[model samples]
Target: MVAWSVCAKRIALGGSRNWILLLVVFVVYTTWRETFPDAHSLKTITFMAKMKPQGANRPSQSIGHPKIVQDGYQKAILLSYMRGGTTFVGSTFERNKDIFYVFEPEWSLIFQTMNEYQPLQNVDGTFQDPVWIHDADETVERLIQNYLYCNISGIDVTSLRQRFMLEARYTKPLYDCVRMKRNKMANCVKNFTNVCTSKKFRFLKTVRLRVHAIEKLLTNDPSLRIIHMIRDPRGIAVSRQGWQEFYQAKMTFTFGRVCAEMLRDIESVEKLPPEVAKRVLPVLYEEVAENPESMVEHLYKFVQMPYTGYVREYVKNVTHAAKDNTVGFSTQRANSAKTAYSWRAKISWKLSSEIDAICERVYKKVGYLRAKSEQVLRNYNISLRDPHISGSYVDKFRQFRIPP
Candidate 1:
C-alpha cells in the first residue's frame, strides 16, 4: 500500500509538469501566429531567430534592442543641412563595402508631410514658406531611430516608395525585390534586414533632423555617433541658387532660415552633457574639401571605422575626376577644394555682404571669418576659415554668447 501511494504522487507531479509545458508552447505559438500572420513573415522571423546567438532572449538587432550594446557593429548618422555637401561627405562611408549606407531616409517622411499642405506661393511664383508640420520634429526623430535600429518592417510601404530610399547602394537588392510582381513586400523587407544586420557598420545621412532632436537616441545607444556637417552660409546660398527649386524661393528668407538653424544646432551641441557631447563630432565642409584624406581619416576614427586603402583610392579618384557640372546633384569634382570656395566668385559683393550680415551669429559661433570686402571675397588666396578653430564646441562657443 505504501509503494502504490508513492507511485501515484510521482504520476500526478509529472502530469502537472507536462500541462505547464503545453501551456507555455500554446502561448508562444499563438503569439507568433498573431504577430506574423503570413508564411513569409513567419519564415523571416524564424530565420532571424536562428541568426541570433544561442540562449539569447532578445530579438534580432534588426528589430532593435532595448539598449544598443555593441555586438561587433556600430551605427552612425551624418547630420547636415540641405546642400551642405552631405553627398560628398557621406561618400566616404558609402564607398566602403563594410558600411551599410542609407541616404536621405527622412525624405519619405518629409514627402508625406509636404503632401498634406499646399505650398504657399509668393506673387513671383516662388514658395513663400517652408512646408512643415508641427509634429514633424518628433516624427523625424522616430523615423531616424527606426532606421538606425534596422526596424525595416515598421516603416510604411508609402515611405519605402520614395525615390531617395532606393538611392543607397546597399539597398539595391531590396529595391529590386520590391519591384517584383510575385515577391511579397515582407520578403523584401526581410532582405533589407538581412543585408543591414550583416554589415559591420550601419550609416544614415540626413538633412531633416536637428541636434537636440536626437538627444534621446544618443543617450540610449552608446554605440551611436553623429557627424555634424556645417558649410559656409555663403556657399550654401550660392549652391541653392543653382538649384531651381530653391532659387525660386526668396534668397533672403531661405538664407536667413539656414543660418538660424545652424546657430540653433551649435547651441544644442554646447548644452549636451560631457558623455553625450563627446560622441558628436563637428566636420566643417570647407575643411573636408580642402584636406579630404586627413578629414576622411578623422571622420572614420570618430565613428570607430577603419580608414582603409580602398577608401583612400576612392577619395582620390572622386576628387580628381573630371568636373561634371551638367548634373545639379553630381558629386564629381575636378578640384574639391576649389569647389568649396567657388561660391565666393559666383556671388556678387552685395549678396555676399548681405549673407554675411544675416549669418553673422552663425559665423561667429562656427569660427568662420566673414569676407569683409569685395576684394577679400574674390581673393582665393585668403582663407576665410579660422586656423585656430578646432572641432571643440567649448572653444567655439567661448567667443560668443547666446542671445536672450
Candidate 2:
C-alpha cells in the first residue's frame, strides 16, 4: 500500500511538470509572433534614418534580460563620416527596440547631469552621467530614445561636453573597454560597430553629438563600413519643413549651400586612393526617391547582405507609397508638407518672387518645371519641367515667410 501511494504521487507530479512545460512553450511561441511579425524578421540592421521626434514612452517591458542584452550591444559601435546622414539616421537607429545605439563619443557633451554621482537635471533639461554609464539597462536606453526631445526644444551643449571630457579623464579605463567592444561590433559585416562618428548630435549637452574625437572612434574601429547617402542639395535645403511641416525649421544654410557642401565632400573622396572606393558606395537621393526599391536593394547588395524580395517590397512600399490615404489630396497628416506633382497647380504668376524662385530652383533640381506651361519628368541633373516631379512640400515655410 505504501509503495502504491508513492508511485501514484510520482505519476501526478510528472503530469504536472509536463503541463508546465507545454505552457512555457506556448507563451514563447506567442511572444515570438507578437514581437516579430512574419515580415522583416532578421537581426538588427543599420539603415539610414531621418531626424524625427521620438515615440512616446510605454510601460516598461522587456522580453529578454535588458541588462545582459544592453551590455552586449553597448559593446557594438557605429561609425560614419559627416554628411552620411548620421545625425538623423543614427538617432533613429538608437531608438530601436532590439538594438543599443550610442551617439558619437561626443555623447558626453549632450548628457551633463550624467556626470554627477546621481542623475541631475541640466538647464535645458538633460540628465548627464558623470560616470561612463549610469544604469546599463535604463539610463543609456532612455538617453538614445530621448535625443530628439532635446532638439525639439532649445538645448545646452556645453555642459554635456564637460561631462564627456570628465569621463574621458577619470574613467579612461571604462571608456577604453567601451571602445574595444564597439570595435568588435563595427568590424563585423553586421551593423554593429563600437566607435561611431557624425557631424554633430545637435550641440545641446541635452541633445547634441560632438564632431571632435571622431578620429579616435575611427582609429579604434578600423573595419568600419562607410555608407554615404548623397541627396541633391536642391531638394534637401527646402527640407526646413522636414518629415513634418508644423515643426518647420529653417536650416542653418540653404539647400544649394548644403548640397554644394555635400557634392564637394564627395568630390574630395574621388581624390582618395583608388582602393578606398571599395569601402564606400555613393547613393544619389534622386535615384532613391524615384526607385527606392531597387536602389535600397542595390545598397543591401553593396553591404554584402541578401536583399530578399520582402526587403525590396517593404522599402518600395514605404518610400513611394502615398504620403497618406489622401495621396492626391494635400490637406492631411496635420503638417501637410507633402506637395505632390500637382503643387504647380497651386502656383500662379501672382506667386511671390522668393516662393517662385524657391519652387523654380527646387523644380529644376527635382526635375519639375512648368514647360512653357506644362510640367513633365526630367533627369536627376539638368533640372527641367517634370510633371511627375512631386517633391516633399515646405508648408511651414509659407507660414513663416511674408505672403508671396
Candidate 3:
C-alpha cells in the first residue's frame, strides 16, 4: 500500500516519463492479484491509486462501440481504390432497404483539401501529383467513426450540405430537409440520426482510405467489418483511360501506385491479430464479376446478412444488362463476367505488358496470371485469373517482401 501511494503521488505529478512508472505499477498490481487471488482489498487500492482527481484531462477513448456490445448492429466499410469496381459492389448494399449506406463520406475532406492545396494537375486536369494533407489518416478515421456512431454534428456542416455526399438512399430525407429552412436542418439531422441508429446494418463505401487506416476501428469495434476490394491493375488502367477525371499522359505511374497500395493493404491485413483480421474480407473484382450471385451470397454470409431472393434478383438485373453501358462510371454490365476481362480487348499489347510487368508482384500476391503475348492478351477464352488463387491466399504470401 505504501509503495502504491508513492507511485500514485508520482503519477499525480505527471510528466512524459510517468508512463513508464504507470506500466511498472500495472505489472506489479497484476502480478500481485494473480499471486494472491483473493486480494480484493488490493484490487480496490490499485484501482483507486490509478484514479485521477477532478479537473485532470482524461485520455481519449477510441471511437465506436465496444467489441463485446454492438447491440446486434453491424458496421461495414467497402474499402477499395478508385476504379476498383466499388460502385458495383456498393450498389448491393445500397439497394438493400435494411442498410443505412453512406457513400464515400471522406470525399468532403478530400475535396476540401484538394481545393486548399491546389495540387498539381495534368494538362487534362487530372491530379498528377499527390496532395499532402496534414493528419490525413486521423481526419479520415474521425469522419468514418463519426458516421458509424451517427454523430452527424462531428462531421462538417459544409459536408452535410453537399448534395453528392448525401446521395445515399437512406440520406435522402436529410438531403431534402437540408435544402429547406435553416432552422429545420437541426431537426433533420436529429431525425437522420434516429433513422441511422435504428438500422440493422450501417455501411459506407470509401475509395480514398487504405486498409491500414481502419485497423484501429477493427481493433476496437467487433461489429465493424472490411470488404477489401481489389481489381486487376490492367482492368483498372483500362477503366481509368475511359474516365476523363482520371486521364493522364501515361498510366504506368498511376497503375504502379495502385498495385503497390493493394500489396500494402494485403500485407497490413496479414499482420493484424487473428480475431481482428477475420473481420476483413479480401475480395477480387474479377471473382465477384465472374460469379456475381455466388460471390454476393458469400459476401452476405461473411457479413451475417440474409441473402434474400430480392437481392438475388437485384444482382441478376444489374449484372445481366441487355447492353453494356459504355459510360465511364456506369455500373451496368451486359455480361458481368466478360466485363471483368474486357480490358483484354481494349488495352494495347505494349500497355498490357507494361502494366503486367509493373504489377507482377501484385499479380503473384493476389493470384492473377500475366499475359505472355498479344494473342493471349486479347483471347477472352483464356482466363487471366488463376482458378486456385483467391483472396484467401493472402496467408500464403506473407513471407514475401514488397519491392522498393
Look at candidate 1 and tell me the lDDT of residue 30.
Answer: 75
Best by lDDT: 3
TM-scores, one per candidate: 0.75, 0.35, 0.74
Whole-model lDDT values for every prediction: 0.73, 0.34, 0.73
Judge candidate 2 against the unseen true structure and give its global Cα lDDT, from 0 to 1.
0.34
Give the per-residue lDDT digits (tens) of candidate 2, residues 230-251: 4333233333333344322443
In model 1, the runs with Cα more than 4 Å from the true position are: 1-72, 115-132, 245-249, 389-404
Report how far off residue 72 is in candidate 3 (Å).
Answer: 3.0
lDDT of each residue in 1-404, candidate 3, tens digit only: 69878877878789868877788778976754443332237445456446543332334334454566465788889989888998988888888888889887877566545432322222122432222354456556877888887888666554565555555788877767866766555677788889888888888988888877777877888888888888988898888887854355758888788888888898898899977878887778887898888888878777776667887899999899998886745778999988888888888888888889988888887888889889888888887878576544443432121111
Candidate 3 structure lDDT:
0.73
- Per lDDT, what order, best first? 3, 1, 2
Clashes in candidate 3: how many?
Answer: 0
For model 3 the TM-score comes to 0.74
